[model samples]
Target chain A: MEKEQQKRAIEALLFLSEEPVKTDKVAAALSTTSVEAEKMIEELQEELSAQGRGLQIFEAAGGYQMGTRPDLSSFLEKAFSEEVSSNLSTAALEVLAIVAYKQPVTRIEIESIRGVRSQHVLDNLLKRKLIKISGRKEGPGRPLLYVTTADFLKYFGLKDLGELPELEVENEGAE
Target chain B: MVEQAEYKIKLPTFEGPFDLLFHLIKKAEVDIWQVSIADITEQYLAYLQSMKELNLEIASEFLVMAATLLRLKSKLLLPRSPKFQEQDEEEELFEINTAEELFQRLEEYRAFKKAALHLRQKEEEQKKVFLRSTGGQKIMVFTQQESVYTIWEGAHHLSEIMQRFAKIAAQREYVPAFSAVEDFVIARKADYIYAVLRQKRRSVPMKDFVIESSLWEVIITFIALLEMSRQRKVNLLQDRPFEPILVSLIEKQPELFQPEEGESGERTAKESY
Candidate 1:
């Protein structure tokens, strides 16, 4: 396929997909390798940026998805009459930060970090589908492990877990 | 007792002694920049005395705030040279700003609390309208009680089981203790789902997958399943009202189920690798 045609196809795939579309899947569909698909995607991203559209492509959860530009979210919210806004309570935001920094983490670990029971805050985040039960911890009582969902990545505009800013250890070797 | 009840009724939720001081400052409309510490301290102690009379629970937070106010008041009373007035002004201004910030936060919190009450009323009205509309349909709606923690707990249990099984498989001697019912599918995609379903069958719920495996194994299997899902080799389904999700093998993906006689050998090789 022509480069322009391939770019359109990738755009269509991302738009139609309910979940993040992996680069390899896009490559296989276009009969190209992942490296080629990635290059094409990079070119397409530049093209989209040059056009100055409200939508931008984002890499998240090891895949790509079409996301609303941060600057345009307020306009979109007004246009769609979106009732559910992402205004988190201070406690909920704190818990979310803890979970994001230390994921595949158990509730006990989170609570220990915050010095309080995080059950209510965890419940609220799960209801919003921003965080999910990724799995369980293996110990005396199997504690459920929590991880940020793709929605979380998309909402926060993060490429992947690797994109999280490296935590500055206050005192690494003091112990 | 009657007088104490009346007194308690007038006081808002006792946040702390700082909150009480802030409340008095706001009511007095005193410029925080020029706050008379002696007057504020006297009012704060009076409030504490009143709280004691009301028999309300007085936490250490309240007592600590009292001590802090007293210390600040004494600092303000200290005689200093005219040259040091600038330093004192800066320090006093900072103290006032801190108190002002706390007061603003409390005011914002109160506004939110009031808004929450209004929201509750709106929710009640909506619920009434919903019930009125649904009067004809005998639909049974069940609210799912499960939370993320519950789901995580289930996954945790499954990973533990997978870990135990992996350990047994590694020992070689303990491998015979496990039952072998289905033929091992060798194709990479088929093996991924088969391994998961096998683990699921043993645990009954997919949460068992997490319990049965080591952290590393659970993570690998999860990534493998995710990759397979991306490839459309398997289907993952979940229902509303929080039922345990069912992952089924999609038969259309024939490449996934293809068996290899050398599968066990390949598994051993993979383990070694």
Candidate 2:
């Protein structure tokens, strides 16, 4: 009976949380060990799957959250009544590509490559959370370093930085 | 039979109106400051007539420039009152010098084009280097068995180390405030996965445990994860690649069992890797 309650608690936690909930936090909240919570969560996951519900539990950012099942994306899209559009202009795309390739790079470096003021483009990418200011570089002006975000990887279908296309110089003479 | 036309009229094509003007100026050997407008206008029209016969698509911009030259020529040809001429000398000079601005703008455009080409070449070169370095490295590990607990633990460990380092670094006057742990945590996601996998366990959770971390510690943690993954000391699992990559330590590699490093270099065995 206690085990069944713990399983229900895991299900409840997964349902109520807005963000992915860590197992440790869930275990602590339910006054149980993480190992026990893991087992219960697994059982609850199977039960939820067996019910053929629209929602399914998935791990993200080191926690479990109840999210819409992938198979039901089309139905969810209709229900949401909005399409997410990412219409980046050529200039914005160029800036984003530069940041992705030479990450932890400064604005000056980005400008040098683009040969134009990238302030507006950088601002837009930052606003969209596609790229972010990783930190400031140690220099005279302390320029901020830019890097691509997790959303960027997810959007581009990349697993990691190493997955980014290799840049190659074919003709040294032309340069 | 078409080849039987005995006389073929050869038409002269100037590179552009500017080229024709330069040619006329050179032939006349006249100073541009005191150019004879009537003579240049005649030469320009002749070139335009020749272009018309060739059935080439004459752009309006070229014709507009021709009209401008004609207007300037007409003004230079008319005799003016001494007082009026004296009063309008600056205006006349400005009118004559309008072509100079066009020439300058063209020069600037050429320079910009050259610079863009050079930049593209440089970028291509840089891309080559990037590709060479990343070649044949199947570093990304995706699995379905990942749990939230492992991801949280890994992020938490890295965050604690980063916070401690940030605190120590902050004591020095020159160092800037430490970056938010979120910055390093999100950026080094692959490393996080690698770290979790270093343990014999194959799954971890996904969470925000990496909110505040120092730079050096984050790098070290990331490297440790990579080293372990490379050694096959652990395996990573996740439902999807970008979701939460869970790491499980394989039981054989006991050295991979070092506890999470704490603020004072002490290991938190009960709560760590």
Candidate 3:
């Protein structure tokens, strides 16, 4: 394919993808190597934003995604107002913060840290697919370990868990 | 009694006993380590008494914390031996099992609560950027801007990533057998039902909405119907068991679920990379 045609084909794949499109997927579809595909992706990302296009491409969750410009949210709000937002309760956010930082952590660990019962909150997070049962711990009763989901990253607009702000623990070294 | 009821109504922010205890300590303007246990214990008991008077069923977690506070309060009542105070830092660390443990937990909760606020900010900031739906996503409107908005990722332990990511990143050739499913498919099905009801203007069999006839599509359509019914947009009726459900729109529209139209505008010029 011509370089121009290749860009168009790559754009179609990105558009079709609701989740992050891996570079390898784009490479396989284009019959190109993954390195070249990643380079093209990087170039296209710069081109899209350089033109200040309404539709923007970004690298998130270790893959590429096409989304609306954050600054242009006001203009799109009138048309997409109803689906614009769904704010979570404080309790949900607290539970999510714990699960995000100490992920693959168990419910007992979360409850002990909070000094409260978290079974109900954990169940709700599991239902929402914000957190999942990663595996069972190797200990008494073999309690299930929980970890944040991709949806959790999407919900928080994070590219990865690495994007989460560093948690400051003032007395972290307390004996 | 009236005051306690008022306080209970006003303090919905307190999700549990620790939250209430934290609130009392803050109100006293005392650091968690410095708070006089007796004062906070009395206040915590007072709040529990009010909860009892108001007939609120206190969860055992709150009661457990109450018992804990009372035990700590009794320690304050004990006469301090001079020798006990003269003990070194090692002894103080052991003493932490009884008293400082509660403070440590409270401090940990405070850190997580602060982290939650930071996450809330991230959520709000991300809300400014919207995503396109899969399949029927419209790309008609064009927006142009001069200044660039960039969000950079922070540093974290690289070893920590999803199992899925490790597989994809390590073996570049391993194409996922299928495209990972996003939540938009169900939303699309829901929209399809709206279009069908608008055109027919009569009760339609639910099975007619199932396009692929796959078990997955059947369940997806059924869930969409349930949601629409809950929102009073549609009513599902089945005259007999195992009968096809008849779905019809409610007469009064609730001014919701309006389908968005793609607007045409001057195309923003795109420069070649």
Candidate 4:
């Protein structure tokens, strides 16, 4: 298909999908290679933001999602004025940061760092689906290893685990 | 010196020992590596005192940290004689260099705490974006703001759901006495009657099959006798209403197992009668 037609189709598919659309899906739909599809996505992203369109594409959780321009949230207040504030508590946030940075880490590691009993917070995070049991550690008692989920990325507005905010620490190689 | 500790600090909330310690270190306005152990320990104990005054129960982890701080304070205050300095404490806390290790821990916690703050700001920014949805038939944005909200909302009813499932599991243990009607098969009973008659070369009383005295088996045996009689493969005779019935083969049919009309499965007791 033509480049313009493919971009329009990609936009339509993204707009139609409730979940983030993968580049492979776009490739399959347009009968194009993944590389070409990704290029088109990038070009389309640039075009939308350059024109300051109402919709902007975000690369998140290993897929592309089209969302309203973050700057225009105030204008769209009428539609979603009653949106609940789902911010987590500081304690919960701290635990999540630990799990995010040291993923597949056990509860003991997080608790030792926080110098608190974090079992309740870990349970709450599990209940919230922010973190999940990745597997059991191969240590004594085989404690469950916790890792952040895709929903965690969306929750924190992170594109991927690599996008987690920088921690200015010199002992990166310690653990 | 412990009794001289003052209660000037008012901590709003401390998640745990490290949080309180971090706050004290921050209040002192000193770097983690440069923290004055003597001053911080005094302030920490004072806060614990305030927590007690407010009737706020200090967690055991806080007490452990408090104990650790005091031990470190004494180590710092003690004169560094070569013999005393070389021998590590009996507990060997933090591999003998408690002060340096504690600083490293504080530094790690501070990094994570800053990351948490960064995430919080990201959360605020993320909320404003409002991923564009098509007002999908009956889309309600309030419930879908965060994917985690749906999970928590679903979790809210989890107790009620698990309670219902537990009831179902308890009920599953009860085997309803007569409602379990699938075990007996008429065709299999008819085959047994055929085998008995063939072996005896004479009529076999139906009471032989109904020896168990179970109502289900007796009912099924009677039905099987009637069905065999209808097919003309056996003759069923009863002297009276309550008398035991006799079942006998009329003609020798070779291999009666396979249904002549290609009917595959044995009729369950619940199917016909």
Candidate 5:
């Protein structure tokens, strides 16, 4: 298939997909290698950006998604006017940070670090689909371990956990 | 000196006691290692007093820290003898470097707080970039088991399916008791089960297989299923403990565990009587 046709096909697929679309799926659809498909995606992203389109192709959580430009949110909200606000409190933010960094960590661990009970804060995060009970740590009482979800990455505009800022060695060594 | 300690500071934005400690350390502009524990403890207590005066809803954790700081302050004031050994406290306390441990915890929290601020910025930026709402688009149905957006949603879906199944199962009227044992036709009942399995070409639950009235008939059908399983005509799968036992055909094995033609003929003849 021609590059133009492939780009259009990729664009259509991304627009239609409700979830992130993987490169392999795009490659299979285009009858091209995954590497070739990745190049196509990059080219498509450049084309879209060059065009100054309202939608931007964002790579996150092991796949790609087409979303509105990040800075255009206020204008989009005014245009669409849906009551959507994800304002999280400071306590919630702190708990989320601990979970994001020390994922598969237990509630007790988060509590110990915060020097306060974070049970309700964890419940709120769980309700919001920001964090999930990944599994239970193997030990006495088998406390549930928490991990951030893909929604967490999306909410934070992070491509993955690696996108988080590097922690100082002195800070990390204190643990 | 402890009673004389008064902090004019009014902290409006500390998330918790540790956060307050972090602020105090930072505001003092002294290296945490070099700061005097007695002065820090006094200031911390004074802040706690201010919180009490302002009628703030102080959490128990704050009070606990107050007790800890008081203990550390008392320990700091004590005269150390040359032969003094570090004795364990009366309560269940971890290692006793109270001041040092508090400092370390405050540092750790500050690092995460910085990370949180970075994430907060990202979140603000991402909030502007919105996806097209999942409207007017054909929803992709996920039949094959894969991780969906949220496991909770998957679990909730499973529970709804389970409830529907239970409702259907409950709707199945109880089989009326038989008039006599001779009313049970074992050969025909077994054949019916085998035919159903063949028609479905998939695992059929044991509960769905035995919708008969008589106990003897159900027993005979169960025995027949066991015999078929033994002969490799059908495979029994119990996916989990307490789940329904599922019966499936061995696809490669075309021949069923047939009681010899004459034997089934004779059993049918006897069943007719």
Candidate 6:
């Protein structure tokens, strides 16, 4: 396929996907290698930006999705009031931060840090599709471990976990 | 209470004790090391008092923090001897360590709150952008017709199967021991219920209308109540579904539907009506 045609095809896949579109899935569909698909995606991102369209092609959760640029979000919020509004409580925010930072962590570990039971907050996060039960830890009781979803990264406007503010390691050690 | 009388200041909305502590620390703008323990402790206690006055249910975690602050404040008040024993030094060190740990936790929590604030800002920006639900489809209104049709079809098939099963079960020859008795029957159950309602002369819940007996008695009593409702002998006052049915005898008709009494008042059983 021509590069222009390939960009349109990749855009279709990302637009239709409710969740983030994986690189492998994109590569397989385009009949190209994963590296080529990634390069095409990066080029497409540049192309989308160059066009100065309201939408931006952003990568999140180890994949890519076409989302609105953060700057233009205000107009979109006015256009789609219900869908755009989201206000998380402090408890939920703290629990989400804990999950975002210390991912693949169990409920017990989160509780130990927060100094309180977080079962309710975890449930709220799961309902909102922010955090998900990644898998069960290998031990007694086999407690479910949680990790932040692509929605979480998108909501926080982060490209990935790396975008999270650098926590000072030296300050922790100073104690 | 004394703290409540000293400071009439009302704090802003705080998520938890750490958040309040962070606010106090920021408002004072003092270094943690130089921060006056006495002043902070008083302010913390006043906030707690205000929370109590508002009838807010404070969590135990907040109380734990308050206790720690009080301990630190009291340690600051005590005089230090020039000649310190090992145990005295260790105890003083422990108090200092506790205070330091509390400050460290507060600092860590503040960093996360700052990150949270950043995320909040990002969220506000992102809120202005809305993604299309489908492939470039600006509108996506979900319809329930398909799901509704399937549910009705499923219910219709389930009812048909149940009717067929009932016919098959009815035709079977198996009979239980209780089928032979005829005294405690459905027809007589209505009269018995009528007599009880007339005797009591008050509204009674359907479940209570039929005293605890066998499964057969419960079923008969339900049918009897339904029959009485049909005849207008009693009013089945049910305000809502899934709620108890209140059965009260209609006024001015004191005549009971008296049926033949069994020998032991424990009438012999009959097959279900």
Tell me how each candidate scores on DockQ against the true complex.
Answer: 0.02, 0.01, 0.29, 0.45, 0.48, 0.28
- Tell me the lDDT of model 1 at B125: 30
**Model 3 per-residue lDDT at B233:** 76
The candidate scoring highest on lDDT is 4
Error of 2 at A36 (Å): 4.3
Off by over 4 Å in 3: A172-175, B1-9, B50-55, B80-97, B135-273
- Best model per TM-score: 5
Tens digits of lDDT, candidate 4, A84-141: 4568999999999999999899998898788887999999999999999999999799
**Comparing 2 and 4 on DockQ, the stronger one:** 4
Off by over 4 Å in 4: A170-175, B1-10, B79-97, B133-273
| Candidate 1 per-residue lDDT over residues B66-174, each given as its tens digit | 7656766665677756775546444321133233343443343333334333334433332221101122133333323232333444455668867876876676543
In CAPRI terms, model 1 is classed as incorrect
How many Å off is the CA of A119 in candidate 3?
1.7
lDDT per residue for candidate 3 within A21-73, as digits (tens), equals: 88998999999999989888888888998998888888777788888888888
lDDT of 6 at A118: 77
The local lDDT score (0 to 100) that residue B86 gets in candidate 2 is: 42
By summed lDDT, the worst window of 10 consecutive residues in model 6 chain A runs over A166-175
Per candidate, chain B TM-score? 0.35, 0.30, 0.43, 0.45, 0.45, 0.42
Q: How well docked is model 6, in DockQ terms?
A: 0.28
- Model 6 pairs whose backbones collide: A73-B128, A73-B129, A74-B128, A77-B128, B181-B269
Q: What is candidate 3's local distance difference test score?
A: 0.74
Docking class of 2: incorrect
Docking class of 6: acceptable
TM-score of 6: 0.60
What is the TM-score of candidate 1?
A: 0.41
- Of models 3 and 4, which has the larger lDDT? 4
Cα lDDT tens digits for candidate 5, B114-178: 87887788777777778865543354334323312344444555788678756755776654434
Off by over 4 Å in 5: A169-175, B1-11, B81-85, B90-96, B140-273
Q: Number of backbone collisions per candidate, in order?
A: 24, 31, 0, 0, 0, 5
Give the interface RMSD of candidate 4. 3.1
Query: Any residue pairs clashing in model 5, and if so which?
Result: none
